[model samples]
Target: MKEIRFENVCKSYGKTEVVKNLNLTIKEGERLILLGPSGCGKSTTLRMIAGLEDITSGSLYMGDKRVNELPSGKRNVGMVFQNYALYPHMNVIQNITYGLKVQKFPKDEINLRTDAALGMLQLKGYENRLPKDLSGGQRQRVALARAVVKQSDYFLLDEPLSNLDAQLRVSARKELVKIHELYKQTFVYVTHDQVEAMTVGDRIALMYQGHLQMVDTPENVYNRPANIFTAKFIGSPPMNVIDMAFDNSNDSAYLAGQEIPLQEEWRNYIRQTGVKELAFGIRPEHITLSKTQLKNGLKGFVKYVENHGSSYGVYIDLEGNEIIAMSESNKWPPKEAIYVEPRLDKMHVFDKQTTNSIGYPTSIR
Candidate 1:
């Protein structure tokens, strides 16, 4: 396995810049995932690393060797594409052995690698089956076995599970994780599904508008987003962002004219943002509800209920605005009156102007 590095990498199409001055490093044996919506350049980055796309500028290195000038074959990288690019006529064993044969390896070496890969992918008995005869997930495994036979130091998976059904995708994901664990190769995966990234990746690079927003662990990305875009993108139902104004003299923050006591950490973040008009954020899970109005919480009317099995999504209408909250219990409160309270410690404060998080200070812990 080898470390992959992108130094000020830039990719352009005529006048439009699709990837801009990206600097990232994938350490040896790390499972790194690039996540973003289509047109965000996540796939482009993966293709560039695989040497499928030419680097417009800057350098890319695998371990200590510069690979930008090398072709895909010379880059010592294995890639599994979204479509499971397997030969339709070739059986699984043929596809897996094709790479080793081309490399002119000894017959014994070819058999050794192919057998090991097929066994790891749990395709030991289906080696004689053609791609057309195999299930979608099995075909994908055949494609993966082909790549593994190459025995490259780096692996690039570009939405490798996108073609499979949801149930098959789950099984395929588990197999892929097992492969990664067994091989311990440097893995770079690209996908638009945040759930896939969160579950399978060791670290996630959250991208947007052709730029890297944040590279962090799943927990950090969800709990402490770098910006508003990330804050809304990572969560299931997402955080509720409302316009909040702070009164410095009163040492209080107002959410829809309700005076809520600001914790010292939040107060510090407010001072750091230095803006009067800030956005207050709270996750759906962080908000609690009751049939009767509480003393410290805010009052709002129940707008709607969505049953999501084992939990209920409650939307509250406060002053013509909708604030959504999730409750583990599906029991509904009265439509006319429902009190909602936010756990202040779980709140997030961001700068209104820059849209960046002004996080709570460490001393407040």
Candidate 2:
């Protein structure tokens, strides 16, 4: 296992910069995930670490050695691409042992490594099967087996489960976690799927338009977001952000002309920042919905309802803005207005101008 570090890294295409002044350290034997939408420079960042792309400016270190000028073959990194880049003519054993053979490893050592990979990946019975004859999940396993046999210091996977079906992807993800547990190698995975990132990564690095938004554990990124973009991007239905007006004179806050409960910490934050307007955010799961009005609640009409097998997603219209809430009970009165209230302790306050979250209360944090 090895630790990877990027110091003041920058990547550009002529005058167009795709990665800007990145500085991060991936700890030894850590599973770090790079997550973001397409064209967000995640794949580019991975390639740079693999020595496939040269850094425009800055230094990259693998453990104690500086590898900015090292060739990919000398970097001791194993890569698995999204398309399972397997040779169609080569069977499972041939594909897995090809790299060792090219490096001229001994016959006994090659056999030992191949056997271990096949048994660990659960591809023991399909050793002679060609890529065309195997299932999508099976092919993915072959790809992983190939990378495992190399026994490199670092393992890089770029959207390795994008091609599998939903059910198959779950199994594949579990297998991946198991493989990592057994090998304990440094892992760096890239994907745009939030579910995969939350489940597999020890720490998540969220990127947007060549900038690093936040790097932390999944729970912190979800509950206490650093900015408005992180709050909106990490959740499934996303956090509902409502524009609100703050009255600094009396230490009160209102949303759409309705007064909402304000905690002491929140009032202090508003007074300290001296901002008259801010964005109020709360996750759908954190909001409670009821047919009757509740204390410190906003009234709204039920606009639509979506049944999601386990829970019902209720969309309510408050004046002109829309708010979503989740409910375990699916039964609802037709065309009836419902009242929704956000948990005061779970609310998020953000600066209107910068779209960055203001500090939360100590109890909430």
Which candidate should be chosen as best, given TM-score against the real structure? 2
Q: Write the per-residue lDDT of candidate 1 for residues 229-327, one digit (tens) a residue.
A: 889988888888887889777668888778788887777667765776688898999999988877678888888898878799999986666898999
Error of 2 at 193 (Å): 0.8
Give the clash count for each candidate: 0, 0
Which lDDT value does model 2 have at 142?
Answer: 99
| Top lDDT model | 2
Tens digits of per-residue lDDT for model 2, 156-178: 99999999999988998998888
Clashes of 2: 0
Give the worst 10-residue stretch by lDDT in candidate 1: 356-365
| Whole-model lDDT values for every prediction | 0.87, 0.90
TM-score to native of every candidate shown: 0.95, 0.96
